[model samples]
Target: MKTDTRPILSALPEILKDRCGAFICCASYEERSRCISGAVKDLPFERVVIFAIADIFSGIEDRALEIKSNFSNKTNSEIVLTKTHEPLFTANVVAKSLRRIMDDGINDIFIDITTFTHELLLILLRQINRFKDRLAKVTCLYTSARSYSIGDPDDRKWLSKGCKEIRSVVGFPGLLVPGRPTCLIVLVGFEHERATRTIVEMDPELLLIGKGIPSVEHLTDESHKAPMEFFHNLVQTMVSSRGSVEPFEFSCREPYQTARTILELVTKKPDFNHIIAPLNTKISTVAVALAAMANQKIQVCYAEPETYNFNGYSEPGDKVSIFDLDWDREL
Candidate 1:
């Protein structure tokens, strides 16, 4: 069945006035930092919260200090440094931090999960939902990069050298109730070979693709027509006999739709156990996290890249758009 999809005006806009603060994930790429800084300048946010892995916080803070005056001294601003690759630990720490923010009476927030790890992103989304009532507004912001890493031949080889079936941070034993039939939903992105290996090993009874929409149209030779298109073609050939491939398109920037897509699938097929692997946009990763938060029965998994070629990943474009995505307003 065909699905309904809409693109937010592709034209980027300046920051809206209502936002009081921004919560952004720090990234290795300068573009991600530039996007957040540009928006904060226009909104002139009073509170700025930056989340970064401990290893990356130095670079993150250096970039923030360039645009935000007295960044470390601002009473309303703080930086959250987290351990790398430990999602559960990130969840426990971030949950408490966000709760404290709620208790402290910061009600309106703008969130940018552009560079967060999948596990960390998911946990943060749950906290947003957990404190939705106390929070007056929540705007999810993302600055789309001009291009993405296809990885160097050497980097690709290292990433695909071996595949393991280790349980993910959200999927360790006793994490969720068992005994239900499982369905795997993989969000297809640029890493084709690794995804192929994962699909074969997992051998999902049902396979669905959360098709990712690129923030920009130009793609390098290594790039697929769309991240999902590449997956669709690959899955069709690989899983033709195993199961039918389902594709759903979602904007890379408006991640709430990704959350809706996951929720819709779970609701439509409540009997099946859901495992979501987001190998695409951090925005979509946030969506996957949102869904997992709503239902603990759902599992969120991350493919551990042996080493990411941070220098090779596409930098963010000069443009950034800010929108008021008050999803709770409808409720």
Candidate 2:
């Protein structure tokens, strides 16, 4: 199947008119998650699973229950509150559900990727990719935000507050080198603190800062320009001693392009042990997963948050992008 990406308004029901046999999504405090879930509420769903992650400080139980009530669980649906940070546990829940769906002979699925944590989203996508052989259609739906962290931008009050741990994703631990300087490539987002915190923790010898390009077709420019510049300024302050801190641009909306962009960076710095830490949008993390999976030499890392600013993370945008993704597509 061909990979088709479509960015549309939720008001246009005619676009996602096709029925979905199963739905998978994470319950999050962000308004965009609610908007995306509501937008797909009318779609026919025999099974639905809303993963409510119970990490130490993030609070989202109420919202998960609210979202569960709106969807059609004609056959069965569940709100599983998994009590662990292990990415494989999340993978197992999704894998078990996929196995059941395949047992029932359903080959199509819809995944709402609006508010999954970067780490969680990567795990889910990898799991979905594993079952691509049995599945016919994998449609990923995401709602772009109108704005992020409505409060003071520098404070980043609405995003995560502090970094809990900086580590490689469970399955995506890239290769190690006996004698090589480490180069950390970060996909910067609204949370400037987290990116800076990652540098403080990893102490990578070199740095490649990834600032988003607003040129993406799905996401309009300028709304993100000011903050992106802010992100660049803070992340560059790390001052890598081995090589000068470099800056790179990638589409904030497109995944494959960003994957290639990261790959190009990896090519230029072959002497260094490459580590990709994504503190960016869910969409860009999609790129991180694609890039890391494509190149085992590229390890993907995350700065797990100590706490999130659940008060005001983001408000939902009117536009929603739906991708009929072929998980098995070569990168």
Candidate 3:
């Protein structure tokens, strides 16, 4: 990708300001409102497609509509997505639609990935990889949350109320042979127990923790990662009984570097089936997806929450992270 990373909107790069074509994003309840609005204000995107997710949770359904209403005027077209059917099916549906648009001369694509679920994003990448050769100048837009409204370290709750299940994301079913043990790699996020639950459910032989490196740009001020720090300590105890727990650092700001780091980490454990849980920033999620897509032996997984903390999820940060797609990678 390019090294021209603009820190904020004020120092807008000529590319984002001049040529943001076909903007696509979810009409999400939380940070999406901030991302879409922010992009519209700073960038001159030619057309926009907003997906209003028809979520099973009533809490998200109503709130997601509010964003749809606000952006409906600015949006070129609005589509609703239903995930109750299946993630594999849903991802292909979106990917095929995007491919069609690409066929119709919409080339310079920009995706605001602020609110897409990890299940949707990872699977969609696998589907899109089928036509990666046709992709050109596809970029991802992500807004950082200033902080999450996490409860006390001793409290029973954190970002989400409960975990519904820890299942393998459909599109990325990595290689699981008969004799090879599994290695579960997690890019840890703000959630206190989802990663813990994911580890317990998978019960893999190796656990790798991908923690975001500290940053001075409002990110290090992200509540000093009190919740996740406490979480890592808890997980260390769990891994002590099983396989070894290895901790690695990744950049929350730069996705390509994070992707390289993940590939390198998984490459060392050649004897195990690699399963990645992307629970960190959207940029890092992009990294995890890229690494897995480039290597089919590497699988990506997600911990689906039973219900999100609607009242106190997060407030959007001022900065945004952008990553250009490297479609030339053989998938």
lDDT of 2 by residue, 233-306 (tens): 66666454436578788877777777888998999888999999888777778878888888888888878887
lDDT to native, each model: 0.58, 0.74, 0.68
Looking at candidate 2, the ten consecutive residues that score lowest on lDDT are 1-10
lDDT of 3 by residue, 65-166 (tens): 555455434554445565833676677667766765676576777777777777776765666667666666787777666666644343333567567877
Residue by residue across 1-331, what tens digits does model 1's lDDT show? Answer: 0111212223323335444554544544445655554545444455666676665334655655554553443566667766655666767778877876776678877766566666566667666777777877676655656555534332232212233343465432213446666677887665555566667766776777656654443221124344446454665566667755676666554555667777788778677777777777666676666566656677776665544545556555544434444435221
Superposition TM-score, candidate 1 onto the true structure: 0.74
User: What TM-score, computed on C-alpha atoms, does each candidate reach?
Assistant: 0.74, 0.90, 0.85
Candidate scoring better on TM-score of 1 and 3: 3
Clashes of each: 0, 0, 0
RMSD of 1: 5.5
Candidate 1 residue-wise lDDT at 70:
32
> Sorted by lDDT, highest first, which candidate order results?
2, 3, 1
TM-score leaderboard ranking? 2, 3, 1
Q: Which model scores highest in lDDT?
A: 2
